[model samples]
Target: MNTSATLLDTLRAEVDQSLRKFLDLRRPLLADPDLAPLLQAADEFLAGGKRLRPAFCYWGWRAAGGGPDPAIVTAAASLELLQASALIHDDVMDKSDLRRGMPAAHKRFEALHERSGWHGSARRFGEGAAILLGNLLLLWSGEMWRTSGLAEEALDAAMPLHDHMRTELMCGQYLDLLEQAEGESTFEGALRVALYKSGRYSVEQPLRLGLTLAARGELPWMERLCVEYGRSVGIAFQLRDDVLGVFGDPAETGKPAGDDLREGKRTMLIARALGSATPRQAEDVRALLGDPALDEAGVARLRAIIEETGALAACEEMIKRYLDDALASLEQAPITPESRQALTGLAIAATARRT
Candidate 1:
């Protein structure tokens, strides 16, 4: 029941090892000239991360009074694979130029085609390859979970939650895509989309899955408490990301300073700013928010407007409120003291992170 920082570090190491082992076994299955790159892509993508999902899952297990189990680490690592799949697909969809400080999965594949002097459209090849790779990662996530060697009973009890997590992630992704096209999204809609896309999957379900596996059945109280904590904190996590999207240092964020603005995401910040703006101000934001050719000056203008319109202040306030709620919920939760403390630290780290 020791959920210390060291324990988190240990879990991260174990998860990384488990991921490497899985990749080693799976790589041979695709042992071919054409498919070598797929394994390489997965390996590279999996190299580094915050390991948030698995951390939540592992801590949930601990919170349920479960003892340490290596199989759990192997199974929890599946979340990382799921994350990879989502990122790859999302980058492709967004046509994002960078990921984790490197060329995006699709762009890398595209570069491969160009270097090889392959025929046909390089962009298409890159996009197609990245999509297939993402699909492979998704399948591998399930495989890792299924073969993690957690007791069959635990696996069976947890399988439904696992499936639903994936479905919810996709559901959220669709909502995000929908918001972009549907113009003038409301604050409520943006918040809803954030939860659907990343909030739940990021914190709640992973914790719930861990608890479910430990209990080997449903726990009504645990579920109820986790939902509140995850919803509040999870939404805040995305909001923090939105804040970083605009104001984070590039070196810290591993992306350009103004990528979110360039993408014109209808995030809560944008929605709030628009909601509170004068007609001229709103019109100016609309002109520069998503302009692909937006220069440094334009980004500065938008940032100033966001700050001046009180949207930046409002988003920060919302994040603080949600984070406070999440921490308070954990205080009264029926879990181990160690877990509560670990989760408290995790709450701050996830929401207050610079990257």
Candidate 2:
């Protein structure tokens, strides 16, 4: 019997090899040599993330009575491609300088433009190229899913879920952009964004899709329970991210301290803190929350206010509550014991992570 860590370690290895093999096949086919940088960007960016989506997808299959099938692993890895596309596009929209401790795709391309002595506006060229690269990755994700070598019956069973996952992902991105532009959010409004963006496509849909692919036929009741389980874990995951964004160690998170505060993320942590802060504290937050030039002193001040007002503790409580609910449902999920252990481990790690 595989240990829980062993199971995930093996799956992660399989997913990595699959990503490299898929990228290698495409590397030789790009007609223009200059376009090579985009491939490198995708490869490196793909290499750095935690592989959470693929893990969820693979476990979903296991929970549905599926055995150890490498084909399902290959299919699950495709979600990473979709994830890459979303992240690259987000970097562009946010004008972020770094991703996963490296230059953002747009900035990378801009540097390449400068090194090549390419003409025209470097900024425009870089951003335009990055956008197209994101589009290319998006297309390749669909290709990967379509050609994953699963049975046609299984593919058909999972295709609608895949379609919805993609739709929700894009819609979530748009909603995030709109939310940021709107300069504020209500608690309910922020939850709506989390539902579609981080919660649905990232966890719930992928889990359900994997289950559907291996199912003998429709199992609506099982699917509904899985959704409930996935949604709860997924939301907790996002909320934990918000807490880490404010209070995590910079080394563990691979970003500068208070990077979210610097970026003015307007996360639930910030919203809740403001909602509960004393009048003086609220005034301090409003003056500094979105200031790009906010320094260590300013970030520390805001963090203090957040903790003093109980927002940080409140978010932690919510994560624990949601995690408990998810685990409770997972215990009664009709899945095998091994699958239950794996799912429970994933939920805990995803929520308890520092990064």
Candidate 3:
């Protein structure tokens, strides 16, 4: 089999195993009748994630010369739990109703409240239940890590990375919220947010954590390479998501088309459109950029305006540039040929993902 296929199979197996373990760990807590609402939400929220984060973590371990062991697989699974927790909270914050083609955790709770004719506001019930579910996942994720049986030194070294990932992700999320509220996000600001929230946790930290777990010594050069590669892939992932948010088929993407426009996400494409738009065009674009009231026609018009303004082209060019940078970084890394090839294939696949 080809290298990519092998890597893909390995990752799938590992993630499947990790998910079963995750379900088992939560089984006891979920058995109580009082916890039914939260438990159901948790099960639903975690059921259909693509397992991208855990796959990345697993590949990172393999790329760092680490053999696949139960501990490593468990660590990767822990990352998936963390990802699920983050998404649960994120959907609540974004006021998103659909995730992975179903009602988000908050929305599910709200529906249940309404169906049962509960007294309180359904919105509050939804948000509250989702928050509790998120907290449960966070705690469970930590327990997974603790039970991994890795050395104390390994876990200790990974602590700062873990802390950094959470801090940066939260900071990035806040930065995004502030920018959207202010209606003025520079390219630099958006890039910073993408790197912190997506790039670091999605790529750099996973790679470093895996390496640390394997007791790999200080790899300053390799670290830099990973950051560059991560930043590139992260940006590409977000850019693709932005495109899908606006143009992808709802059936395929599992969300409403043009959801980003409705949410007024200040993406790189949006920033570029503003930069390229004429004075009158700028006003037109700004009017619809953050307006939650925009209908389907309004969204289509906005998308056309962005395309006409040459912003879409600029965004595509930027993605290509980052992919190039990622390739260069991988070429510069001093890992074995096999590891380098695996990383390269992942970079290609990540940049080219249609979904």
Winning model by lDDT: 1
Q: What is the TM-score ranking, best to worst?
A: 1, 2, 3
lDDT of 2 at 171: 93
Model 2 lDDT per residue over 1-355, tens place: 8787787888899999998888888887885877678777788888988788999988988888889887888899999999999988988887777777788889888998898898998888889888988999999998888888889999987887788889888898888777777878467767777777898777787788888888945675666656679999989988887788789887777566787777777777877887898999989988887677889999999999999999898888888998999988887778889988888878888888674
Tens digits of per-residue lDDT for model 1, 179-262: 887876599999998888989999989999999999998776797667778778888999999899888888887778899888
Best by TM-score: 1
Task: Extract clashing residue pairs from model 1.
Answer: none
Clashes of 2: 0
Clashes of each: 0, 0, 0
> How well does each candidate superpose onto the true structure, as a TM-score?
0.97, 0.95, 0.94
**Residue 173 of model 2: what lDDT?**
81
Candidate 3 has which clashing residue pairs, if any?
none
- Model 2, stretches more than 4 Å misplaced? none
TM-score of the candidate numbered 1?
0.97
Model 1 lDDT on a 0 to 1 scale: 0.88
The lDDT, on a scale of 0 to 1, for candidate 3 is: 0.76
Candidate 1: Cα lDDT at 58: 87
